[model samples]
Target: MTRPTRVDDLPIRDELRGQHAYGAPQLDVPVRLNTNENPHPLPEALVARIAERVTEAARGLNRYPDRDAVELRTRLAEYLSRGGVPIAPAQVWAANGSNEVIQQLLQAFGGPGRLALGFDPSYSMHALISRGTGTAWLSGPRRADFTVDVEAARAALAEHRPHVVFLCSPNNPTGTAIEPETVLAVYEAAQAARPSLVVVDEAYVEFSHGRSLLELLDGRPNLVITRTMSKAFGAAGLRLGYLAADPAVVEALLLVRLPYHLSSVTQATALAALEHTDTLLGYVEQLKAERDRVAAALAALGLEVVPSDANFIQFGRFADADAAWRTLLDQGVLVRDNGLPGWLRVSIGTEAENDAFLAAVKSVDVVTKKEQQ
Candidate 1:
């Protein structure tokens, strides 16, 4: 029999030769919270609306989708303007997911001979996407609490003079939101160093306790804030993500975007979701409350809980995070061990699911109890 060729056998780029793909485990567990997904299903009303929209779109599937996704961009612009930022359709761009948004941004602003920087332990995809685009990746510094250290970040920006700087608000894994002051500092430093593109990944902003950083876009042409429907809209399956930036940035992205990148069905479904924005955001409020409840409950158990502005909570001082993750999994509850030593992240699920997860955590002895201060 002929041998099956291994991935290593293919002549792939040297940068990708040994790297693992970015993903959390997809195990079929009773209470799955590993992927930071919004646990709620779309409302029946919205489901019906999506069906109507998709059906309307189906009639024209023989033709290519809107190359610029005009109407979708207009609706997204209006939706963002509710944050008081007054965004225009010309300033918005949509893609498959925030991953694609990041990929496109890197393709345009970063590549061979250019470097991209993100704080250590923020989103892994920023670095991964940079590598895929052949852009050198640099890891900046963060405080022990997982907040970006302004001075350290500025120093790194000055030292590396990276062409692209990524800032993730309500960052993943740790669930820490970058302060507005820190974002401003980094943006200024990035520009001072090399007039770099500062992309803020706001994929979880809807669940934050603070206001959206959308207002910061004013006068900062180098700034970009990326968002996703996967979390707050409960539409991960829809694969819709977008960014709000200067009109010039949008124009630049046009140069790198695939022709008719968004499918008609995607645009139709996203428009349907936008029509029910208020309803979807109501779920965000519930998850915010549940997130706080989960954080407090974890603290009450003497486990260290990182303050989270996003829909997920990062808890534990587990001596062995992998073992703790497995223990939780053994109990029919799954959480993310984000390779951050002593920590694991759990998405805010429905109240009942959260209760089940807390119960499973209570059963485990792997959690290192936080010492009373």
Candidate 2:
């Protein structure tokens, strides 16, 4: 018998045999606007709080972390309730990251022989996680402008009747927010087709021009709203994400989550971050302003910039986006080529970082050279 030298030779899962693990390239560049990370480092006061909290938690490290993360959940609920929508602790759940929160949702409500649906060019993770959990994935339609066409979406929902539906408000790569009317419409269509679980991935909502859909969870048991601290909290390295849904929905996820899934250190750090939510949110306002500035500058340069509510701008109608991406990378600025036909996304950074990106764009003369080329 021949030795198994490649993945193809091994008895791998049929679906995963040729699949690539999903992620943007984490390049070591000077200006990394590629990954949509909060450019601000965690404030010093919060760092001190984290140290104090972790020291206390370390004393009890011999025991398993709060298997349920009850206190952490309670604080999270309080943090979310700042919107005037009361979120009870029981309605909140936590995991290592929003990616894990999504995975657990898929495990509980989606799996072998089931289907999950999302609009294309949205978060890629929705499809990848679905496949990883043995759930069939379906692509819904987005209009030329990247907004979901309500009628087409409803038709798809009725036809496919997916076990899970993902709606990414302030959608990744595009930075467009889904209107409440569209979400309501989609939820109704899903319910009519089947008792489906509709997940609204609000991972970037903290920097949005509009409010969160968390308030809508009151009457919609099938609805779920997932959030992350990575973006707004300036704690991306902390790896904490959570969701708000009906208690019953959270109860379903409980069955699929591993024991002690959240470490004591994570809980401590997240709790510390929550204590400084006010200060952290001040940074969000700054990013939101910078996002507007970047979008304006890109449009002024004659790039086709999609209107953004999130903390990034997707721009371009480049004849070869990869060329544009490579050009920027050469200038020590990195942005994402999200595989969209002629578009790329750049996360908003600090004032100086954003300035560097703009300078690079102007220096490259991307728009002017296109006509000459």
Root-mean-square deviation of every model: 1.9, 1.4
- Full-model lDDT for every candidate: 0.92, 0.93
Could you tell me the lDDT of residue 166 within candidate 1? Answer: 92
Error of 2 at 193 (Å): 0.3
Which regions in candidate 2 have their CA more than 4 angstroms from the true location?
Answer: 1-4, 371-373
Where does candidate 1 stray beyond 4 Å? Answer: 1-3, 366-373
Clashing pairs in 1: none
Q: What is the C-alpha lDDT profile of model 1 across 42-127, one tens digit per residue? A: 99999999999999999999999999999999999999999887999999999999999999999999999999999889889999
Best by lDDT: 2
